[model samples]
Target chain A: MQVYVDGIGILGPGFAGWPASRAVLAGEAPWPGGETEEPSAAILPPNERRRSSALVRWAMHVAEEAIRHADHDPRALATVFASSGGETGVLDQICRSLASPERVLSPTLFHHSVHNAAAGYWGIATGAQHSSTSLSCYDSSFGSGLLEAAAYAEVEQAPVLLVAYDLPPPPSLFPARPLTAGFAVALVLCDRPSRRNLARLKFHLEDVLRDAPDTLADPGIEALRGGNPAARALPLLTAIARRRSSGVRLDYFEEQCLSIEVSPCPP
Target chain B: MVAMTGKIMAPLWISHYTVVTALGRGLDSTFAALRARRSGLRPCDFEDAGLNTYIGRVEGLEDLPITGAELMPFDCRNNRLALLGLRQDGFEEAARAAARRYGAGRIAVILGTSTSGINETEHAYRDRDQDSGVLPAAFLTRYRYTHNTFSLAHFVRSYLGLRGPAAVISTACSSSAKVFASAARFLASGLCDAAIVGGVDSLCLTTLYGFSALDLSSAGPCCPWDEARDGLSLGEAAGFALLERIARTTDSGAVALYGYGESCDGYHMSHPHPEGLGAILAMRGALARAGIKPEAIDYINLHGTATPTNDRVEDLAVNSVFGTATPCSSTKGWTGHTLGAAGITEAVIALLCLTHGFLPETLNTTRPDPALAIRVLIENQERPLGRVLSNIFGFGGNNCSLIFGGL
Candidate 1:
């Protein structure tokens, strides 16, 4: 089944939102190389804002952006939040507490340490009682999430929101799975083409294995893609930004790749 | 069965299923334990968190060997339980046969886990070097395969030697239950011919103490629906099922996944909606997807965590949907609340009821909560069952209900 992308939200180091990142992806502007601070999620209530972690903030930021961009009711869409490792900052704190003599874990931190904490916060903030799923698949998290969201949209025949995000682990975990930067990408997908659709994505899971990575015109953007699994969406995002019909291959598993043939819908 | 308003999903056959939990390994022991109404929860003795609570910990995991040499990097309590579960009831052999029949590339692995090998990280932090503030080299080497949330699915895919699309859903306690929905989607989307769906969550200091910190851990074995129920008893478990399209299955009496529903409470992070609004949506959605009415359900494996809030809210939800006629019980009293693994654990139990024509009681509950309107079974009863609904709710208001029935 073909899935249409109605909206896109991109956040990463030096790239803030879809409007600014579109220029960078299209090579219309130079790649801005700098550290980007975490979003505060000012849209959330004060109580929720105080409890929100960087992961929640990033996830909510992109979710709101995508829903708003689509001009869709947040409550109407099902959601899939994908992350490689969830709330590593909270993980580190809990680990440290458990390792200490006191073993006094913070109640708030413990509650928020769950893998679906971001999805929970999003539901509360938006009063969206629709179905929400949080998932991960190592380096293939983005691809896995995309497939899940697309498949759900197809089966439910409804617009589904897909959010893929990953934040770097603490310094202690750096040597093992080194993630240089945090990134998040969101796509609002529908089963059928609609007026809000930015592009039509024909997604297919091919049995053929492909190890070659898509090259970016700028080495820096490629670095960003390599640095984080979520940033792997950069190639497809770039294709959409350019409004060009192109095929983007995403690494899915050891022996298969998710091949998407993108055809931009005319406004 | 009464007709429903939503689309009826094609049934997926449950070819093989297994469970490894405190009730003992494999289906036989778990079923026997359930028949005897035995409680696997013991006083909390896991790694000295010093909390007054009960835990349902799988025995002998410390001695269970990791599946293979390449799997050493994934060695941890969670993965060990996963491997243990895979080896039980000849599940590994069955999975291998399916892989051969369908071709490895057409089989997908979707597992649920909340804390995948986080215990190893906790140990690493405790043993960190005082001088350089660095963790042990061994910990770092296995961090990617051990601690990452996706490691469970990655390990399972590698161990089983199947290469279809894989994912790790981690929506807390409802994690594994949602995998059935995802697998159905994958099969419906023609992404895979068959899917291995399950969940594995192991006992860790993080969960034990974390639940304790939240004051949600029970001092004694949990008693779901009991008038005096206080809190939940944390437990660890691993459960798996091989799902295939019913059209391709030749078995005459294969149990099939009839329907599933998922929803978020959007009410509270740690607490449930007092009215069980999300639970109602999930249960109703499941029936709608199955094209059946609430009265058609013979049994319900409730997401009864034994906490006052959880049990009370679930009672309301069940009462709201199925009324007081559906025989309902919470098996958590036998295995404790397995969290992420609870979904599959209960799913396997629901399947067992269909196979054995028995109804499992809510173990350890002395009396059903009189305030609740739903019927809460307190003893095992023999009855022929055709359709069963299993409920799994999680933190962050994630709720999922699944319908399983004989073809």
Candidate 2:
């Protein structure tokens, strides 16, 4: 189905919020290229240069920018916030509270503990009256949310805000990092448009086997990390925000095989 | 007539339900206890969990083993319910046989869960720190590995040696119910030969207090559809079924997903529209998709959380859609609210009605809701039903309705 991305946002290490969205535009982030867990400079809130868990930091920064970019008047568009690792740190904290006397769960932490908290908070802040969702999948978290958003757009014919991000594996809980650092990407999908026009986006679902011999090829990469990783939305958002058409295909094959196609519109 | 392309042949036999609830373990246990119609309400003695309300706790998850560090985490409440569900009615063996016959890699494992393994993460994190600024080394890695999504996909795949696409749908309470639509899409698109779609969500701190925060929890066992219907009784469960294309052989037959309607209410986050407009839209959509008349529905297993607003709104929608004569009831009184798993659990219950020809009673209701305007099955009765509908509406205005049929 064809849907227009009216807005976009980004947040994470190396940069913060919309400013951090530059990584996607440049198509590169300079790093030591090793296991030395250094977060990229494209993420938001420049203060956190050396810290880990950039995913959480980035997700928060990017979401706010998304609302602003869409000029999102929370009174309208729906939302879908996705994360593969949902509040890993919070889960760690709650488990800690369980074994103690006078189990006092933090009200602030608890409020954000639910999977939909990010979406909920976004809604609450923006005064958006539309429904919101929090989703987790086997890496396809973004794809699933996008498909659902696409369905929402096709069926309900309304604009939707989609966010995908992952915090650094809580070092206190689990550890899988280095290139796996945190980042977030957002887009506003609607049937209508408002802008210094960008390309119209169409999505198609394709299934590619994990063991497919050519999975390492371009087509496979398009089917694997191209369509909807939330983070991968960065490439599309950056390209569009910079007023460049240059097509890009994303592939996220783990949960489901899906691809997003972008073709520029004539001004 | 050229039927909907994805629509498979009708099934002659109905499926059976084997529920695992705090009301004692198996279906025989549930059914036997159900015969007497007793409520299994007991105090929740969570490991220092402060909430004092009662829960429909399923025993045995505590002793269940985790594959890695107590920190690395293994089968948690989510997986426990899955194992419990697989144990009932040779579900595992039956699923195994179906996989073997169809070829092992084709039976997709599609599950719906909330707070998948946070119970483990919650426990691990607390032990590592008290006033610490940084968490312990062990918990950070393990909690991230298990809870949200990956562990669930891996856990199910490893346990059954399942080789198909492993997916975990976490949409809060709507998770399981929505799986029906997803499975149908996959089957229709020929993505998989068959699928075993269901939901498994257990009681956890996130849900328990989340509901409490909204003041949606009733201190006593919930009274769904009753005038005194207070709130939801938190519970845990797992329910799944074998889904395949229509084959000529009249074995278990095909219980294909005939139709599903999904819509966002665009209403409130925590509450359903008082008019049930979204609920009506969903029901109507499913009916239209299935090409069936509203009056064709023999019974409806209502989402029926027993909250004042939900029961009232759902009642209005039921009356408007099927009129006041459609037989319906809320099984939540018997099973408590299983959240994400409720959709599949109730779907299994509805399927059993078609197989057994018996409409299960809405166990305890001294007085029906004065606000309710539909015909509710207060007592058990056996009736011929060609089709049935299961309704599920979750937080955030997510609305879904599923239709199943008997040949």
Assess every candidate by TM-score.
0.98, 0.76
lDDT of 2 by residue, A177-258 (tens): 2125455777777766557224577654333223321122224223323322445554455456455555444334443345
At residue B128, what lDDT does model 1 achieve? 96
C-alpha-based local distance difference test score of model 1: 0.89
A99: Cα error in model 1, Å: 0.4
All candidates: DockQ: 0.68, 0.20
Identify the runs in model 1 with alpha carbons over 4 angstroms from their true place: A206-211, A254-256, B1-5
Candidate 1: tens digits of C-alpha lDDT, residues A1-267: 688998888788878999999998888888897997778676589989887898889888888888888888888888999998889989989998888899999999998999999899988988888789999988888988888998998888878899998888888777777898989988999888778889988865555324654657788888888889898888889989999999888776544567788888873
Best by DockQ: 1
Q: Where is model 1 chain A poorest over a 10-residue stretch in terms of lDDT? A: A204-213
Give the CA lDDT, 0 to 100, for residue B44 in model 1: 89
